[model samples]
Target: MSKRIQVTFTKEQWSMIEKFRGILGESDAELIRNIVLIWLSEKSIITTKIKKEMDDENGNRN
Candidate 1:
């Protein structure tokens, strides 16, 4: 099942979101979901790289 979430943003933030939505032709939900998914993927890559670097520094690898 999917969960629903509520997000709060300032007027300026809402304005930007609206502009992007109009330009991209995506609904608010779709835009938010896409942004979050992309952010997660990028974060995961950065985290993996950091962990690998730390492991190498400690001479540990599997």
Candidate 2:
């Protein structure tokens, strides 16, 4: 079973989403989901890089 979610967006936000959805020929939900997934993946990469940098800095201090 799929869970349902309710989100509220401002007029400008909705307008941007609609424009992208129309250009991509995707549903609102699909566009939103893709954006969310992409953002999450990017954040994960950033976090991993930060951790690695921290580890390298700590190792150099030894």
In TM-score terms, which candidate is top? Answer: 2
Candidate closest to the true structure, highest lDDT: 1
Model 2: residue 43 alpha-carbon error in angstroms: 0.7
lDDT of 1 by residue, 1-62 (tens): 59889999899988877876855458888888776766776778547787788789899985
lDDT (10s digit) by residue, model 2, range 1-62: 57779889999998887877755458878888777766876778647666678778789532
lDDT of 2: 0.75
lDDT of 1 at 25: 51
Assess each prediction's global lDDT (C-alpha) against the native. Answer: 0.78, 0.75
Each model's backbone clash number: 0, 0
RMSD of each: 8.6, 9.4
User: Model 1: clashing residue pairs?
Assistant: none
Lowest summed lDDT across 10 adjacent residues in model 1 is found at: 16-25
Reference-based TM-score, model 1: 0.56
